[model samples]
Target: MPSGGARASIDLSSATIAVTVHRQGATVPILIDGRIVMPTGVAIGPTGQLYVGLDHAAARALPADHRYVDNPTDLLGTPTHTHDAAPPDPVELLAAVLRQTTFYAAHQIGQPITELTLTIPPHWGPRRRGHLDDAAHRAGLPAPTLVTAPAALTAYATTLGLTVPPNSCVLVCQVDRHPATLTVLQLVGDHYRELATQQITTPHDLDHLIAHRVIDAATPDDDPLRTTINHPPDAPADDRHALLESVRAARHLLVEHDRAPVLLPAPRQPAVITRDDVTTATQPFLDTAAHTVKEVLDAADVDTAHLAGVIVRPAPGIPALTERLAHATGTTPGVVDHPHALADGALALTAAHQPGPRAAAARLPRVRLRITDLAGILALGACSLILLLQPVLTADITTVDSYVVGARTSVPQIGSSGAFAMLTALVIAHLAPTTWLAGTPTGSPAEPTTGSLIRRGYLAAAVSGLITATLYGLATGTALELDYRPYLTWTLGAALPLAACTALIAVTAPRIPADALPTWLALARPAIHYALLAAAGMFLMRAALSLTIPVDLTGMPGLVGSLGAALLGAATILTITDSRVLRALAVPGVAIAYALVFTYSTKSALIVAYLAALTWWAVRLTTKTLHLAFPNAGAALHRLVNRPHS
Candidate 1:
């Protein structure tokens, strides 16, 4: 879940339908007016008779060539016989079923269904997906969006308020009639990337195993029921199908009951099956399922400790598999109980993000430098030029720098010209162009004129110039030995306007939308904001103390060196820990420690705070630049930074 809420708020309407086709059948589950309406899975028979859900039993009683179960797995292979004459194209049959399912859902909801989303197995490649798309088109419907079942399961998990943070891994285990699929999906950005997937064949089907158990309990050793259970394919199709269907129903009934009766074949009594019987029958399958999950995790190079969550979509017979998966992954697994859970997931994903290549392209940051950016660059260049020329232009002048350099000497120093330029550049850098901190506002108009930007730049430069000149005069008048009173007054006067400017820039600057930001930047945005806030506070503290506390100008060098070393040591220690709150608290704690240690002469403390704030800002900017240039490395570094201490 995001800070606001779950990211799976789907905007479903009558025009859209979500269909899931798996080993058993096809389901159309639609959400309308906050209610879920699922129509029965439909099929077509050899005689062109339409079979809907349970009515499929009648179609199954027909000859082998006249009826067939519409299993999605068959799409991976050649076409099969669904009719007596020319076999229907597997793609055509699937399309027809989807079309029919759509119509059925629309009729039930009393609305037209235009858009379709189909969920398939994770291992499905482009070819299989293409087949599904072709079927949708052949059915006279628009090309359907295809989503992987594992990804869909994750979407469903979000609906349950399960939070899988970015860069974390989620293990999804789905046990159906065909084979158990174990997939490790990592949440990269807003979507999930498949890390590893494996389809493991269980030694025996849960339903078949339960059916066998029921026969053993209800019949004699030499009874026909025993023979039917032993040789299922050779038994009468209707009897075997009916018995299996009844067993499946009993297994589901056991979900809410301790025991349920399974209807046996004719001439036999119904066998009462217990929940214990279902659990026992599923033990082998559960064992294999757990092992498969472990293997997939290993393949994905994801440790159990790093897993964000575990989700299980168990077959109708084995909800107990959830516990087995939980034990395997060391995380409680969320069980998906809805029969059309995959379809629901697919719909959520579709609504949240666009599918296919278009979505992939959309995730990339699209940035283009505009006129305001160029104006900012020019302003910075001019400021740099002034700073560079100040030394040469003032070489002949002897300036007293008792405040910074101990004693007056004939040397070039950071005079009015250079300080003004530096401050101007800083202000322009924050105000003129959009940055992560100062982004372009959504739905804002075009950039301000270059002249307007330049005027703002010069206004900032003039303020910095006056402040520097006033400080210089005060330093010289007091013989560079001013007490805390005058310094504190100057600091407060300067800080007030600087803070106002910063706030104004933050409010007026255009902000980039969160979606447009790179994943690494988006994930680090909160941390970056905190860092900037801490840096700003430190800078303010430095401005106040650098002038206020009287200092022995002679020992300033040694005092400054000691403060720098202490601040560096503190930063190094703080960086090693991953606790954000601790890091945030440590910033002010270090400042207070410095203030106490250098109470008699806070000039060194002032220098240390200023350098610390500047260094912090520089590092944050460098990190943002590196992440934007090399996202993969940035993501890795983010994981490293967020990793637990252990």
Candidate 2:
């Protein structure tokens, strides 16, 4: 993780991690072996995805506690991939960098990175910095930090004599698609100070038009949306050949259309655009950058009446972009330099301003952050915490039979993957412990009447019975006559099995101190809860989706059998090594149950098998739930269910 303590012996030559980069759109890795042999372009990883060469970094930066996030669930609660439409994630950059760890094996000869030098954009604020730090920590690249892109460039340049004439200014411009940054430095005797820097994203109707045109070229099967280069037409081209060629293309386009087309160079591409072409396709962007440079100089209130020459940089070789810059500044030298010039200037400034190696380090004071109310954020966090725990606390008994059916779906005929089965059971296990929490809420003091207790018991039983019956009737339809006796027999059969599980919860719950209930429930039960939540999620989702005439809750009977087998396997595994396997076993069983039922049964049979499975799962689910709830009687009842016949 990113270092947060005292300095350690860190060697730059050996303390390097391979970083893969997927910027703007290029998804690939560019390895940097601490020693800076690379000069063209350095790789920049997003946030913090880092790995040791050919090895996994031992992550040690997560907060003391962490909770499960509901993975992207399908419309019916089945977990789905978080790929498409995942918010514009910086994490991808981190991932790319971490992937580079593999290439290290191909060509190694080094020690693990102990210190990291991360490069982030200057525009990013403290919050962004904090998040980046966290990411770096997770990747095991934490230490004496380096947090600025320009700063890193300056450091590199300083090693190469990094000096310029006094009273001269070196302006740097990074011409890329989104925003173009323009920074100017003032050389005061021995140091180069940043006079002004501004980043501006072009805002013109031309890009919109071009964007529309680009999309129009795509087929219906394509991933239609695409982001073009961030700059307008005038950004300097890196090569004469590229610039001339693009100008030729633009000229050809000009001949074809009465209105000029917007010109933008793709990020990282070596294409060079001409000044006229840039002005035509993307004038506003260039104008903004140019205007900012002029304004910064104006703000300095410099005696421009007799200032030294201005060295304008249009991203190194892009003369088209720089030609205009020089023209605007009217500097005698008026030549474009490399983009790193500003960073080099900054390094010189820092070094000249503070001569010694440990200069100004102690002068910095402890800074406190000032903010407004945190109530909204705190409330949101609390609400999320509550909803996450809701399933464990309340035992509605509405679909306890379905829950058990989820258990029984483990039947082997369906060929459930062991992993899938455990997943389901774990899900249930999470909710089960919670179902029996709080000493089962004892009857009120004065109102403790046997009759009322009897009513409550009957009410629980009746509610469970009705929900099971109604769901069954709906799932099975009226045709297949269910021998109510056998149905009840199967449900009752679950009582013993469920009671056994409840017994364990009853035994464990009381042992945990009051404060630990939420802790255990939240932390230890993630796998268990998520799995069950996912399974129940699948069941309801499948059923809900089947809203029309005879919608299949799950596929077929064989699947129900498979689900039952999976559950059985999970029970065996858990018995041998009682891990969080409930949800693990059940979700797959439920999923497999649906698939099997779909494959084996006729449309009519699907309803019967699904409802039957639901009934079974519900019974087991509820019985176990209640067993965990009331310790004295619940525990006794649970033991009775699991115990051998007298």
Question: 501, model 2: CA deviation in Å?
Answer: 83
Q: Global lDDT of each model?
A: 0.54, 0.35
Instruction: Work out candidate 1's RMSD over C-alphas.
Output: 14.1
The alpha-carbon deviation from the true structure for residue 70 of candidate 2, after best TM-score superposition, in angstroms, is: 24
Q: How much is the lDDT of residue 575 in candidate 2?
A: 28
- Model 2: how far residue 79 lies from native, Å: 24
Name the regions of candidate 2 deviating beyond 4 angstroms.
Answer: 1-109, 150-169, 186-193, 204-276, 303-318, 332-646
Q: Could you give candidate 1's per-residue lDDT for residues 1-646 as a string of tens digits? A: 1111111211111112234321101233544323453223335566666443323465566566454544533544555545546654567666655666665555554444545677777777888778878887887776677778889888988989889988998988777536678889999877899999997776557777788777777787888877776787777767877888798789778777888988887677778988888888767777787788778888999899879988877676576788888788889988876655667777667755752121111212124556755564465445334322332233222336633333221111223222223344444443332232345434333544322342354356445544553554344335434232443343333333433443333222212222222332332222222322222332332323233332234456445534533453354335334468877777557645654464325533443344344334434544453444343566688889999996
List the candidate 1 regions with Cα displacement exceeding 4 Å. Answer: 1-55, 58-66, 72-76, 79-84, 104-114, 355-646
Locate the minimum summed-lDDT window of 10 residues in model 1: 1-10
True-vs-predicted CA distance for residue 50, candidate 2, Å: 11
Model 2 clash count equals 79
> How much is the lDDT of residue 446 in candidate 1?
51
Query: Which RMSD values do the candidates have, in order?
Result: 14.1, 28.2
